[model samples]
Target: MSSLRAFVFRMRGGLWTLLFCIILALARVTRLSFLLGLPFVILGQIWRFWAAGSIGRYRGERVGAEHLVTWGPYALMRNPLYFGNGLIGLGWALMSGPWAICIFVAAFALLYLFVIIPHEESFLHETFGTEYQDYRSRTGSFFPKTLPERGRLTGPFSFSVLRKSERHTLWTTLGGTFLIGLKGFFL
Candidate 1:
């Protein structure tokens, strides 16, 4: 693994924070934009919460897959977490300004496509061997795949897992939403 890739992977949180701050700073937020964006935010968070439930505790810098989770959202997409993040980013972009979506999309592609996903995929492929490759072929990376034969892994989706894994995401998203609200309503 490239050291640069590891650094970016580790710095994902900071990068996302920077993106949010950029959106807020360059905002032309309005009531209509906020309203339009709310559904996306809600849906994104829900998707993420569900995905997190299956994945157990959130590991920020650590990149290791202990179990091959092949059920629920994992069964749907190889990168449900990233997909949910995409939705959330789009929502924030919409709320921020007309041009913010372009910026967010560009940033997302650069980060996830160029650095993050490849690194993670390489690790997963090495860690899980044939299982991960099989999953990769059958499942879509960012969307629910229409596999001719979808694989399933048996496991319980725990609320505890969701709570543990999603608190940071929940708070961060709420904070962004609140700031956007302030910008839209007061500023």
Candidate 2:
């Protein structure tokens, strides 16, 4: 892993984590627009679970990948985890029901656009070179659409990976949810 890129990712990861926690706490406190936001949160969690499973199943690393994962969710979205995370953030903001949260969302998007994404892309370009370029050319970075057309990937979506990765992601999501719920009650 490139030290610079890794550092940037870790820093941004911390920021996002903090933002998520704060939003959860506020949501729990204010009750906010829990009705409208809950759906996005649920959808975010579901997407996160799916993306995490895909990553764990294929051994994807946050730093960058060892082998190019061109099957499963990766085939559909070049950056499934980021997309899921974005959804989660957007959902949480909606739940928070504040202009500040919208600003936070916009800032987060900017961070990803200017800092995190570019760093990751440079690393990928350096690491995977042409192959990554080809994949990027064909795949959507944040929105999943169609799988790569070269060859069809087959295999039943395994519950095993889901079971394993969910331990981490699910608990985190549950914590966030509880915090939001508590905020709602207090509000």
Candidate 3:
């Protein structure tokens, strides 16, 4: 289980994207599927951007943070970035236009919840100690438990952070969508 978790933690992002892209490339995607799924992809990107922008200096390593960030999306959900990734993958699955793809998306989410988050949370707990515990006690892991705690917003939204955190995601999403759209167009 630990090895499985480690594998997921290391490879979930790239592997899942590749899986979705490969499936979409081979599957028959209709215009309706592309249309239906686009909103989810957009929303997911927005969520990721928001989370990345808000993290400011804390966007260090994935398994660790320089400081505990409980602002912006962090105030709402413990793992907003991962949640956003789920949305993006689900969007692509929907665009792929097969019920089986949806199952894959659900399975991916389950893996995230069970394998990835536990490992990440363990690292975070070790790193941030009581601060993370306090944040965890109050915040939902994947859902908003309360309104964002009133506080000054973290530093001005940083494009550098967004680019640093999401460049690959942004490009992969666009490229995959383009491929899927092209497939829909030609077939």
Task: Quote each prediction's TM-score.
Answer: 0.93, 0.78, 0.86
Pairs with steric clashes in candidate 1: none
lDDT score for residue 110 of model 2: 73
Candidate 2 yields a Cα-based lDDT of 0.69
Measured by lDDT, the strongest candidate is 1
- Ten contiguous residues minimizing lDDT sum, candidate 3: 57-66
Error of 2 at 46 (Å): 1.6
RMSD of each: 1.9, 3.4, 2.4
Report clash pairs, candidate 2: 27-183, 28-182, 28-183, 28-184, 29-183, 31-184
Q: What is candidate 3's lDDT per residue for 32-80, written digit by digit as tens?
A: 9889888988899889989888877534324657778787788888998
Give the candidates in order of TM-score, highest first.
Answer: 1, 3, 2
Candidates 1 and 3: which is better by TM-score?
Answer: 1
Total clashing residue pairs per candidate? 0, 6, 0
- Which candidate, 1 or 2, would have the higher lDDT against the true structure? 1
Candidate 2 on 152-179: residue-level lDDT in tens?
3432355787887567666776677666
**Best by TM-score, which number?**
1
Question: lDDT scores for all predictions?
Answer: 0.86, 0.69, 0.78
